[model samples]
Target: MKPTDYINEWVNRITPYSPGKTIDGMTKLASNENSYGPSPKVIAGLREKIPEVFRYPHKNLHVKEKLSEYCRVKPENIVLSNGSDEMIELIIKAFKGPIASIYPSFVSYPIYAQIYNREYISSSLNQDFSFDHRKFIKDAWKANLMFLCSPNNPTGKVIDVADIEEVAQTGKIVVVDEAYFEFYGTTAKHLLLQYPNVIIMRTMAKAFGLAGLRMGYAIADPELAEALKKVRGPFTTNYLAQEATILALKDLDYMKKSVSRIITDRKAIEKRLAEKYKITPSYTNFILADVSPMSSKEFFDRMLEQKIVVRPQPKFNGFEGNYVRITVGTSEENFLLLDALSKV
Candidate 1:
């Protein structure tokens, strides 16, 4: 009669996600967070809403309305979640059949699939880490739900809209994670109009700099949106998050300015890193470097010695050689990162 004996066998198979490490006084470029931080208006709004914590969060109609206006979709076509992570799980819960995605993209697609005991399938990215839509479609033929990340995590490469439309043609539920859409202005939202099964997941964590608030949303056809709403918890998004997100949406200029800065810094880092390592072209706030001569672990350790933190990509299905993901930080932080790399 051990508690372990009662745990589901499938749940036991899952390897938990390991987040980026945090250490005092280190320049953190491991996690892809917006180092610029959230807008002052959002902070003020959160302060005003603090006294109302005694009350339960409402149905989130206002938040959805505001998001709808921002996304240019009807309120009924939107569903709010604690973060896009929750939305991924909700999509798993609300759908049936195997989950499919590109190998070595977002780790959560397969992680959540395992949590729910759904079959998971994947297609390998090309040697250069570029996606091959035709190959993926054929490989994922058995999947009924597919997840695609644009300006994909770690690599920061974007999936072209034409490729996404090719996947959507299969009539499977297609979820395009646009977490870094602000950095790369291209969007697959136009596909949503033609394909009722297409869903676009977004978050305020990046350009809006509200990673602490964990606010995210999805835009799909009204019927599909309603289904997701039913599967999610009633109060997953709290009042503070709602208020803060509303304010963030209203302050688009602030978000754009931050994105512009990150984009500029991202290019600078890419240019500098390319002088040494093989740099992956990025459309997001991070760059993935092929530190081939040195093991990723060794590179991480060297960066650590310099009081800098960078993410070492674990061996995923299609990844070869050693690679590290470096988030674009503030100008000072980037300078420090470059200086540290010089020493390494």
Candidate 2:
């Protein structure tokens, strides 16, 4: 074995998450990111906080207080992280067992399992790509961690609250990622009151448009929340992010306007794309379409040729190479992609 063979067997097996490819002057719609920016208040918040950057932000009690009020969970029941991704990693470390998630969902769930050298388990989605809890109910009992993405990535299907409760009943710690919660208009956070075992993961990326700031958090049983803090260590949430998110949460109007545009545009794109291809109606800010006239790879290349970037879901678990996920962008950006698809 070579010197690098010192790596753990699981680490050796993991394929790291690939970000959407970047190209100069391209209309990007691959990462499911909100094309809108954070509240204008964030700019002022940053300017006010920049002078204090030299000081380490002590535990962010004030920010947690704001999040608690927003999520309607007690402050002690929350654990803040750099992003929802960090919260997932912390959950893996704290739970320290096999990671299970619905397949062709978020690719990162299995990737997180590999990074921590934990077992990764999954069950395929229905042929329509919608979730069905009955398929994995038995396997869930065997798992220590369960990552459920509501308004699921790529597919944009939001698992029903009843479906989430069924998985929570299996006794595994259920982490419901609500990264696109604002778009969907439903939350499993109510499950927290019913199930002590549930963990609702949230981020400021999608609706709040704070992806660059890396602010995400979780709401869980107070005991589990405390455990996450121990695993998360210290200072992962830097000063600017903590303050900016607090401000962003206060400006609900900005989020509403941003989400409104995406939802409106999502329907518009779905309507247009449906005329030519099979497209999934979505709750999140993206649409998954079957691009059967061309291989996903060919379609991706075709879009790139038009200076647009879209995600081909075949790279994700359970996809069979005829699907692509297109993010809902600004009107002009969406028009560019739609126009390109018409020609391609």
Candidate 3:
């Protein structure tokens, strides 16, 4: 039999996720990575704990208690994952139901469906990239799992809590991926007390500058958190990641400053780039701009040639060849990108 016969039908049909390329000495702004470096405390903590690698991580993962303090939830109400992507996969693996999310959000949501062989569904966003709230509510009733990406990836649009609460009130499982929560400044965690169905997923990768460490966690009802733990690996969270995340969370002021700096730079870049490219108000660390007169491929190629990289938009969903997502880099890096754009 051919190799085709060995492949599972669902896995074969799903397209794999392609991450942005990394090049040495390139002014990288494509992947939405935090431009700011990690906190002093995080670096120090990681170094101090380096000698402890000979042993397995603490069995209970008491870092959950620290996370509980930061998130204002009890330890049992939280579940940690290798990264937010793993959390999404685990949820789909653990729960048995129809999964639904908005189109053009995080691309990984659909991949998990193929891996677990679960039902996956998506509702397209409006032309302006806003959700059709009425249609979403109607669909929520039928779906058992709803994956919501607030401060959505690529588009950078924020979701209203009122809209989320509407679906949560219906008893549908609403997993809000607030991976960009630091950038957005609001969360659905508050609704969890009344709505046991609300599952808020946050990551240390963005604000904490621990993307390399790969730490992400979910805040959910205590019972739901327990169920997710049953599907999670005993030590999916590494010792370094857990330790660094705790240090980062405790040094809140340091992270807050980094966040403030990125936000300031985002606005500056938007104002200058808006003269040529149409930009939406970003609630996240990246800005999506309409770069017409140049195809997405052409723009991406030109930027790469100049050693300044930005994200290219594919014509998936309703996107044409005119849009590109640019991460909000440091002021110097942003200037370098703007200068490269001028040359292109």
RMSD of each predicted structure: 1.0, 1.6, 1.5
TM-score: model 3 vs. ground truth: 0.96
- Model 1 off-target regions past 4 Å? none
lDDT winner among the candidates? Answer: 1
Q: What is the C-alpha lDDT profile of model 2 across 103-205, one tens digit per residue?
A: 7788778888888878788877887777788887766667888889988987888899999999998877889999889999899998888899999999988
Model 2 worst lDDT window (10 residues): 312-321
Candidate 1, run of 10 with poorest lDDT: 314-323
Q: Which runs of model 3 end up more than 4 angstroms from their true locations? A: 2-4, 319-321
Q: In candidate 3, what are the lDDT values of residues 1-344, reduced to their tens digit? A: 99889888888778898987778999989888887878887887789889999888773456899999999999999899998989999899878768888888898888888788878788888777887778887755567898989989989998899988877877888899999999889998999989998899999989888888888999999899999999998889888888888888789998899899899989888897798888878999999988888888888999999998888988756655388899988778988987887888
Clashes of each: 0, 0, 0
Which of the two, 2 or 3, has more TM-score?
3
Write down the worst ten-residue block by lDDT for model 3: 313-322
lDDT of 3 at 189: 90
